[model samples]
Target chain A: MIVADKKPIEEIIESVKEFKKILILGCNECVTVCEAGGKKEVGILASALRMFFLNQGKDVKIDEQTLERQCDHEYLEEIRDVVDQYEAILSLACGVGVQFTAEKYHSTPILPGVNTCFLGATEQRGLWTERCQACGSCILAFTGGICPVSRCAKRLLNGPCGGSSKGKCEISKDVDCAWQLIIDRLKALGKLDEYEKVQPIKNWSTDRAGGPRRVVREDVAL
Target chain B: MLAEMEPPKGVDISVMMENASRVKGEIDAFVVPEMSNAVMRMSALGGALLLQKNGMDTVMQVCCRDRNRLALQADLLAAGASGVKHIMVVTGEDPGFGDHHQAKAVYDLTLLELLDAIEKMENGHDMSGIDLCGSPQFLVGSTVNAGLSAQALESELSEMNQKIKSGVDFFITPPLFDIASIKPFLSCVDLSKTPIIPTVLLLKSLGMARYMARNVKHVHIPDELVRRIQNAPDKARECVNIAAETVHAIKEHGFSGVCISTIGWEDKVPDILKNIS
Candidate 1:
């Protein structure tokens, strides 16, 4: 799922400083799953902001609302009635949701309350790590289920770089050498013979390097 | 000058002291490796500061894979404040190769970008065009690969040129088993502008040589070198002899000096140096 982190309270306060009335919007999708921009987080952020404004002696009125998902137009339309009650919106959704919400309410400014990090998975309840770079083509199968595109620091397709020492990356102990993981997984699976296969230069046109991408499904197109 | 010390895992002052004292009279400067093995230890910058406090000239190894532009600048400023003037800038190994399997890497700047940033700071400004309170002066260095396939050779040579253009004062090659292998690479370089420091690793055993040959990238371990170590009756003496010979060969090729990595055999450094002088 797409993972995000909440922006610091101070930065959030600064972003909405000019607004007297504000709406703290939340998404019940990926943000909720990752515990970043969920309804609970929305309340926590709203309370923090309210307290901050109270301490500052500012007459700021903040409202809270969470949608099932902010990416869809149908869920966004629910805010059409009460949308005009705020000067700005603090969207606790991914970048996609914030932009979609902005498009939905043309007049009101939608401020991103979270920093959209990457396409990742939650290893534990609180630890989320990147899993994919959304490169158009996938090579997880060849790489023994490890995505070098997302994991390898240099993203070298052939193998681990010279810097791999004691199975750790040169960067930090917190990071696992993706190629090491790939080699280990491949070794465990008895597919070590495939290690010699050199991956050719990737077709990056399918990746973001080409440009902003679009997908079309003619069969489902209305 | 060969000061080789790996970055410590925690703030172990005793180990730092041992490391500092061991190379006291042997090397002119000690190199504090960046977060090697993917574990967060005392940072190279922090380690350099500690060594400098102990009265040793330290070369802080800075990698581009970790910090962004702002953090890099701030750290460089801090290094200058701490009186560390020598730095070896590297396009560090990826974080994915480290212990932290889930850490986010910030490769906001490339090696060229980093060297350029330092150069700009030396001229009295930050990357954002803000005037600096004080300028940091550094005798900057960079790492280069020794043995290379025809493909990597060209690209790496081009990169070395770009680094020199960005104001790198010196270049250090990876731990080389055979100095002759780098002759092709050296021929391509304009040595007058950037002096090359060839590094030699003291091979402890055949297993060590083979392991390095297979796992360590860019290191060239010729078949004969491995065979000699494997078949040698006195492996320890042979290791020192080979290292000493490699150092001699590098100097014979008209290079200034060589960087020796004992690889935990710090005691053997004096032996290797004995044969060299």
Candidate 2:
């Protein structure tokens, strides 16, 4: 899952003020799963703006569409011909989808209506919280797959911080201590000895600081 | 009763952000925001917001079918923060007819919780303990279908009274075909003293009348209404005509005003309002 919060209606309407024809676009990928840039939210924003524009005596031709995935070129191509008809596009997808849509269409202006927060999971109905940092490192086998960089407040590398009390973080009492989780996992795996090894400083350059990392499998690609 | 909220000074229809700014003295706002899922499902919530913004002395709706508790509370708080005057509480429809069939529906806070939440909201706290920078005041309303008669009349009266205790300042009755369905309901209330607005339902299509009657229980659709609509060349168009007459009937019955419920034919609301005047 992912996390996203909707932008205010006034700001959204202001962005598409010039477009007499607008297509409220939604994404069915990560955005829809996270409840950020989904079809339902698209309707919400479109209706809000339509009312706002109509009240101001401005004419607006508002239509809504949700694609399988906006980030993918193939999915966006479905609307290639139709998009040319609209004056502007209001994308409810994440930063990735919005960028993709903008890249695909040269003539139309694409505006984002959601603030994409993070790659996360559905904690409950209508609630999405962060889970993955996409840091290009997987210590899941060693640290129980709970990335401390994303879950831990301080990103402590070793055992629990002194701030840990009752397995909860000092920053927020409701939050669980990530390092404490890592320690418990190490114990269960009989790798408590790894804790005594005195960990070296993290090499982020090898992870993602270098940027745009890719993976390849000869068999799969072939 | 909500008509009193506007300051008697002058007109102030410009929208204020979720801030301290408010529209001063404007009655009868035209709250008709565009409907969600124009491909299928339509809602009056948008209209409610638009009308409130334009200073129509609006009565907005808090539907049960849309958002869960979090979203509902946020929208309600936002509505109040935006200076919405009145709200008509309703149980919204499912999303099958719309684009979002898989989209979840939340009824976490029953009508009671919603009412309680709104009342709590008046004190500056949302259900989540987030305080509003400023207080929000709105006249709460509840929906009642006066057509049901299987239940005892006393039980029906008690239900209406219960919602009243739950913070509903006004009540909007659902649409009815013959006076029989509403007559029993009227006998239960002393409308001479009460301000509860009696709104009748308008059948927009023969398919719609049959659709509603088939799906909803105890909702009385007049036989003649069904027959007349069945005979019409353009049943969908005739629905608007029947709906308009229902509004006129509601007005003739000495009710303060009618809440035109144009479920499938959402566009017919403005026409009904026009005919009502």
Candidate 3:
């Protein structure tokens, strides 16, 4: 899921200060799961903004609404009639959602209320760890389900670099060395021979190095 | 024949200069490490240039951990312009091991790509395919880890082949105390075609030897050598003697050369080389 974190209340306030009427938008997707942007978070932000404005003796109107999923056109169109009523919309969604909402609404300013972190999983309630870098090319089959591109500090294909010691990265004792995990997994699975094969230089063209990417699916096109 | 000299952490190069001058005529070329162990220090290029200015040959080590492709290319061109000839590439230790733990690692190019970029610049074009003002020629070298296990050794050999294809002039292995330990690596890689220089690290103490043997993967410090250091009356002198003996053994085996690494004890390097000659 796309993990995100809520922007500091002060920064959000600074961004939406000039507007007499503002709407705090939230998404019911990944951000909601990560507890960054959701219906409950929308209410909390709206209350905080209202109290902040009340203390300043301002007559600012703050409204709150959460879409099923901001990335989808149908959910975003649900706010079409009321979007123009507010001076600005604070999107508590991932960067993609904010951009999509901006493209659909075009006129009103779409401000991001949460910082989109990465494509990761919730390890526990509060702990989220990154899982993939969307490098476009995947080599998990050879690496025993570990993703070096996202996990390794150096992003080394042929790893664990000399820095790996005692199953931890040289960077930190807290972080588990990704290559160590790969080697151990391979060893356990009796696939240590896979590790003997030297991985060639990765073709990063499929990655962000190739520049802004787009997928054209003729079969799925409407 | 090579000695590893780490650049000083601060501005003062008095100790570094003095150490290099001590063994000036003793060794072939001083291999100046670039902030080795991810510790911040004077840039390797700067250290190499200073040594070169003093009429000494130096192999400047470049790591892909810190700089992007542009910065790397710029530094390479700078090294060329400054007349520092030999270049050794390494995938440096992670920044977490260094003082600056919060710094971001910019590995824009893999080791092979960086080598390819160096080759490209030598061919009179930058990584972007733009023509260079002038090409910088260098004796390119890189490090290889000859693992303890057969599987790991095979993997290293395969990568060594790739690095050779990338035009690496020489290869350096991790510190080796026992020649028998690297027998697997020795049998697999032919020394004549591509020169392999094994590092002879001067163990600071029995604790360091034990720590490296247990903690540092890929490095194999023989039990007998560790016990030898343990039983010595003077540990430091014993460490130096062990280094000298390893260098002599490596020479006897008819390998290309040996790189003597003193860690921070560059002062003891003179003593290590004294017995070698």
lDDT of residue A102 for candidate 1: 92
- Evaluated at residue A137, the lDDT of candidate 1 is 86
Give every collision pair in model 3: A171-B96
Please give each candidate's TM-score. Answer: 0.56, 0.47, 0.59
RMSD of 3: 22.6
For candidate 3, state the interface root-mean-square deviation in angstroms to 1 decimal.
10.5
Residue-level lDDT for B186 in candidate 1: 70
Give the candidate order by descending TM-score.
Answer: 3, 1, 2
lDDT tens digits, residues A103-178, model 1?
8889999999999999999898889999999988899889999998999898889998889888888888789999
* CAPRI quality level assigned to candidate 3 from its DockQ score: incorrect
Ranking by DockQ: 1, 3, 2
The lowest-lDDT stretch of 10 consecutive residues in candidate 3 chain A is A204-213
Report each candidate's C-alpha RMSD, comma-separated, in the order given.
18.0, 24.5, 22.6
Q: TM-score of chain A for candidate 3?
A: 0.97
Task: Give the alpha carbon lDDT tens digit for every residue of A160-213 in model 2.
Answer: 678989999999988989988777877888887766665545545334433356
DockQ winner between candidates 1 and 2: 1
Q: Is candidate 1 or candidate 3 better by lDDT?
A: 3
**Can you write out model 3's per-residue Cα lDDT over B1-277, one digit (the tens) per residue?**
8998888888899999999999999889999998887788999999999999998899999889889999999999999998889999998876667776545566788999999999999999999999999999999999888655688777788888999899899988889888887788878877888798999999999999999999988788889889999999999999999999999999998889999999889999989988773
Instruction: Give the Å error, residue B235, model 1.
Output: 2.7
Better of 1 and 3 by TM-score: 3
